[model samples]
Target chain A: MATGLKIKTAAELRTNYLRREMFPTIFCDGCGLGNVLNYTLWAIDEVGLDLDRTVFVSGIGCSSRLPGYINADGLHATHGRALAFASGIRAANPDLTVIVFTGDGDGAGIGGNHLLHTIRRNMDVTVILVNNFTYGMTGGQSAPTTPDGGFSSTTPYGNIEHPLDICELAKALGAPYVARWPVVSPAQPVKSIAEGIRKRGFALIEMLTPCPTAYGRRNGLKEIEQIWRWYREHTVLLDEWEWVEQFGSPEEREALRGKLKIGVFQDTERETFEDRWAALVAREKL
Target chain B: MHTIQIDEGWCKGCALCVIYCPTRALQVAARFSPRGVHPPELVRPERCNGCRLCELLCPDFAITVTEEGRVHA
Candidate 1:
């Protein structure tokens, strides 16, 4: 997958993609959300997407605030309903590219039903779901993706529930494009975002971002470096994970436990809802 | 020659660029910016290989690396 993406200087990216007045960003120091935004812009630039014809839709959350920073048409929708609003936009004007920015709480918890139906329907929209373990905006509450035994404001003792694997869920739902990447690495996420935009049907790119202020402060990762290094140490590439699972020794496999698998989970062609809708309209002459 | 620029007003003093710089060209500044955080300074400009990794990893969009004699504008 040769993205052929020309690396742009920070000044150029700021001039081209960002709404200058919006900065400095509201994100806390050491938060990985900014990295996510940077990678998305790179992907957009690589794809040569026309900002005029693109729509950035987001629900209420820290991650959802990303669209507000981009220099493009954006809809800051209600909590947990970014995909719903994005669906309306795509249906109204199929020509316009729709990209959604949603958080773990916004997309997988409050909007879990929306996430399911959207993937099942195979909507023509790209979703960037930022999973930072906890809900950073609402004062570090335990989100659906919070790791088991992870500490949060809501979970004073520890999160008893297992963390949700969003990429696996999207893959199971048969989304045409699904991938997950930690923000510690730059190139892979940028490439995956661009590929998701190019993919025809439902595309879900899950970003594992670090929330140093909310999540890290509560989870023993008090320092910025600790949290960033945590991500680097915790994530295992999907290919490597599979190899370890198949052939590694018991101790080696045990060491892999609790590590998140990051990579492209699914990429297969399928008939999108828009294509079916168009077919139905042509047939019924509606 | 490679040069790095730091936007003091925008930097949050995260030190990510300092920690991630491959060539050790950057260091946390002793002086504080108006923002009251110690923005990174190009302490060893000669060591910079112009990889632009700091530019890409900087969450604040506060760093820009440009090779001298080349116009990236």
Candidate 2:
């Protein structure tokens, strides 16, 4: 909870944070990517981050375009390499705060290796990875996080592989901050993102956003209401999930299957890459 | 009283606000905006509770809820 911070209204936030020149974003009518951007801005505002000292880094995707809309320094890096660029920025100027906006395809699929090493090294960065289940910009191809039996252009017959749980992967890698939230609910994500920004290590916030035009139309969730409802019904809070798994009946446990767990999965401090590097330099000088 | 302002230029008319409005005070306007989408209209303003859930859920930053005299310039 970011206490004592005055929460700005949408109008106030827009005037203070957004680049007005980027009016009418490129997101689809029913796409939740815009909501992700909104929640992120709220988080940034709550954290009271100095736009001049913060840098937004993103890869080649619809979600990656977010950095351009924010009135701050941004790096529109190559496909799936946003993390690489962000790492460089962090290493060179540790005083600057780096926030990376990446999509499921761009972050988890094409740049899985970079994602792994970044977390392993515990680089100081906040990653807002929007998981829309498919490659939205490239004509709705099956992404690494696309659920099994889900429909997409590349998976017309239905995807055969299991969906990747990005938050779990981050937790396994010992990320200092890890959370998953659906865009349907705004409050939790805003709070979680703020927490991620304040935490001093690798922080991963996986936002499950609706892709009505891309993923939903093919999966019988074409209507905006339907997709939003699907997200609400399919996602369970982390605490509720644990309780169900521990004490629920067989049918109850079975029903919990395939539902995404949302909430802060982990929060722990660790030695960041920048701190360790500083220590190494000091030791070498002695 | 809270007033709901809908910026037609930015609204894509997804109706997320209308659907998620706790008071059901909003409805998709029959008239389309310049963007060719039906922006939400605050039909029953009296029912609005100033919770601003619509403002928060609107994907497009098209909706703003503000107190009567405290409008942001």
Candidate 3:
């Protein structure tokens, strides 16, 4: 929503980026997948990525369906193995940009081990993980990213376990870039995604999007605006939180509990998986 | 000047466009699409400042706001 920035025409974007035959997407009304996808395409446009050379990879989930809608070379990979598939693609062709779309269940739940290994290797891929706190494609089951006390179909009495912070996990695993953003606003996410795509090694962008049909109704957020309002109310920038942690009292830090600390958590340079592989190949040849 | 265009066939009437419109220029119309949901309509074109909030928030990619008119009223 930044003013004065060059905005692409809808017709042009649809013709160039989206698969027009797939119009009227299957996402439920008020769902945030559209927002996530829009920000992603905007990011690709901003970074001037060559779509012909970019490959999209995804696993089984609502968010994973993203690749099928875009007019690009993509693999609708198996369940919980998008990163595994993407790593193979990256190893085969280091020059092509590999982007992975995954949901909380697909990325953090069944695929958590693969995610860790992929980050540990510092694979040359950009991961866009949409965490809606529930298995939106599978009937509102509780997901690894579901907040404590969150209500899902499987957790009728409310969830007891704490949520997994994907950004913290990725940063701990030494990803080259990690960021998180709520889907309420597109400006920050669009910019962050663009930056992630430009990074050299593993880049993870966790998007807290709303699944109004699966997750919202049970959580008393039947309205999409309410979810947006909740994001505006319950989220804080990580930089601001860090500043407060450094300068403010313990009580001030305590107030941050349950508040989603979003924004770029880390961005550092590192040799990517392909670089290591190339060195190994040359040394072996010698 | 600004103009709002909505693809009624594409719109699912989630009303994110209607609710996010800064000037209240868009509203959910009573008529339903073949999809059975009422689509949002541009009710007040003159009030729009081309913010594109509706365009960005719209889950359906239904709304598009464009700068229009070369002269002021």
Please give, for residues B1-73, the per-residue lDDT of candidate 2 as tens digits.
7788888899998899999999999999999999898999989989998988888888778899988898864
Candidate rank order under DockQ: 2, 1, 3
lDDT by residue for model 1 over A1-286, one digit each (tens)?
5546696898998989899899999999999989999999989988989999999999999999999999999999999999999999998899999999999999999999999999999999999999998889989999999998999999999999988888889989999999999999889999999999999999999999999888899889989999999999999998999999999999989999889999999999999999999899999999
lDDT of 2 by residue, A95-195 (tens): 99999999999999998889999999999999999999999999999999999899999999999998888999999999999999999988899999999
Listed models, DockQ each: 0.79, 0.82, 0.46
Q: Please, what is the TM-score per model? A: 0.98, 0.98, 0.94
Model 3 interface CAPRI class: acceptable
Residue A99's lDDT in candidate 3: 98
Error of 2 at B33 (Å): 1.5
Error of 1 at B23 (Å): 1.8
Off by over 4 Å in 2: none
Writing each residue's lDDT as its tens digit, candidate 3 over A44-148 gives 888889999999999999999999889999999998999999999998888899999999999999999999999999998999999998999989999998898
Candidate No. with top DockQ: 2
